[model samples]
Target: MSRTSRTRLRLVGALTGALLAVVAADPAAQAHCDDPPTLADLAQRHGRYFGSATDNPELTDTAYTKILGSEFDMITPGNGMKWYATEPQQGVFDWTAGDAIVDLARAHHQKVRAHTLVWHSQLPGWLTGKEWTADALRAVLKKHIQTEVRHYRGKVYSWDVVNEAFNEDGTYRETVFYKTLGPGYIADALRWAHQADPKAKLYLNDYNIEAVGPKSDAYYGLAKELKAQGVPLDGVGLQAHLALQYGYPTTLEDNLRRFARLGLDTALTEVDVRMLLPATEEKLAQQADWYRDMTEACLAVRRCVGITIWDHNVG
Candidate 1:
């Protein structure tokens, strides 16, 4: 499928139809911070991009736009645009909220990175039925990618075409995508999405791949193999779902450098350093420093694209 044909097969619609109520901060809701740095502002100072995935459907408020104005160059709507969320039932597609996110990004002159195209989680109940076969599943996957990517066309900067596909042992996870479509699923997804929007970047995103261990090695090796085989994969997404309890990776820089050496672009997809309980003032500032260091690491590597904070309200 040529990109031109795929673009022509797409459908665009007005997002104003699914209007949502404006969110109001509770009068008693504690202000997290007296003044927090806007994503754009942080990006400009650090010489990198900063952004987040908002949990809003209507997008009627000024939050996303405000972040864009502050220096954030990207916006990902998270699960709001996932497979199940967008088209829960077979053949019934909805693009109201997704369209709003892209439109808002365009209005702000910011880039929009689509959260994901395929994943084991958040799959609709219908797609996971008993009679699901490889052929039937392949058709569904291709159609979904073509439709979604074509709808956005040149709007989306990149798509996480395949998320979390490997386990700790360097073997493929038993996800429906892998189980139904086999290991070729990843390559097939990239090809389809690339055919849909050739100019847009495509990435493979996953968590727990930030360390220089079995998991990270598996991902690094897989990415190298894919690129070597001429896969249309354009980039890699490091979810960076960090935890304070286990402590951060000691060889974080080494892991990132290894991936960058694979000759593919990389981005910090879901960056949030979380503790068990509410964050303290000290923890917030410490987390910010960690974030600064993470951005510094990205800047150090030529292939490290940018850093995207999953959320701005660290406090």
Candidate 2:
């Protein structure tokens, strides 16, 4: 069998038990793709990184850990590296959870894609409890970004410096950062993170921006503006959280191409195709096709880095 056919068969096997049973019926199928090429392997062949988000709790499960270690070339902590977990109290940092994952990735010879230095959600209670002057909030934001980035400097491959900053209609989300620090906070946060870790790639990540529309247009405009201003921005991350019910973003490849044209690396970060309740065989088949299509899309673009599943198992 051809490598491409084997890849398709393994992808089917990984997604559906029924498909796996069918493949098992043929000894040649098992021998050809016995140890299927992991997403990481296929991505690496195209000079990209393939990864997934994992929580610390799942790390304790041996089966889960084994799959994570062997099957991926990169890893992102789902929540351990967030502001609430890392710096629950102001000026005091706890590296326990994030460190554990980083160490695991190291043991597995995998790169770490540190998530979310600055985000509207998962912030510490101390930060959200009070109203503050622009100056005070700016200082707080700067400290958080710098401290977090510096702690993980040289260890992580990239950082989602800012996440979900814009809304569906290309308007800025009125988070505390925007409300207090103004729209320039995005640029400010990116600069601060770069200052802390000059080597790590910085990204602005968001969802609903997979197609060439308002939300994506906002990012394209902002990315160009930032680059012109000599901002230390490196990439844009698309949280391709698709649902079979909602359908796939057909213009996803074109959208990624536009970002690459801006001299920015693009990635399908936090990807998952979820469907309602009990999944049918047809839904599973559709889901598998979506996964294959996304991988092919990334491979087609030179600057497209890789795809990271939101979690290990797709439900």
Candidate 3:
């Protein structure tokens, strides 16, 4: 292989290691950084990036924008690209929200992780208002996925093609697409997305899959099946929305390694160490430790590409 290819492979193996804790001890939400070596700065040294999710509304606030643009290299559109916002009315597309955030990211020289092409929630009324035959639903689903993917084709770095497809128990979610189109909808969604934008990395994004459990096992089985069939799937998004009450899932590293063995990149996609309202110092310290542990696990895996924090605010 050429030198360029070798370097590229090295980066691919070197772990972009998305540290969602881009919100850190330096106070991620704080307007100005009094300290040198920002999280993005450090991550850049290792061919990695830390990211935060920002909505269209948050762009105008100078304080938020200051931290957002300067701290994180990868920006995730929190609600702009979801089904309800992008295509509120059937065939009547609105790019106002999604485009604004993307434009902001571009001005700052940051890449975009376009969220959620297909998901159960946040769908428009046209889609969930009434029932339809399998063929009609499939057509609608395809048009939505392809149109949105094509519009953002060259702009985005990755697309969360299918989001939250399984329940906590590893059962297929009986979503509109699933109930009508059945389990094959996921493979079809990934395939259609690849056709629209072959270069964009496709991912199956979900929560409660940060560890080796029923939900993640469901994804593992599906990923194996898709890879075997030569479907265009690139990675899995583990929304590591950890809670202080439930305790951290200690099996996360092993879980990431298993996905790496599948030849797929993994990410702590929508991470936040949530806790009860009475934020105690003890709990806060534990949260910080949890974030650190999670980052170390992803860094340990070669195929772990990136992480995006669910919320950008710091305590």
TM-score of each: 0.82, 0.89, 0.88
lDDT of 1 at 309: 55
The per-prediction CA RMSD against the true structure, in angstroms, equals 11.8, 6.7, 8.9
How good is model 2 by TM-score? 0.89
On TM-score, the candidate that comes out on top is 2
lDDT (10s digit) by residue, model 3, range 199-278: 99999998889889999999999999999999999999998877889989999999999999999999887777777768
Candidate 1, position 285, lDDT: 56
Collision pairs in model 3: 18-307
Q: Order the candidates by TM-score, highest first.
A: 2, 3, 1
lDDT of 2 at 180: 84
What are the clash counts of all predictions, listed in order? 4, 0, 1
Provide the lDDT at 67 for model 2. 75
The regions of model 2 sitting more than 4 angstroms off are: 1-36
Give the runs in model 1 whose Cα sits over 4 Å from its true position. 1-47, 63-65
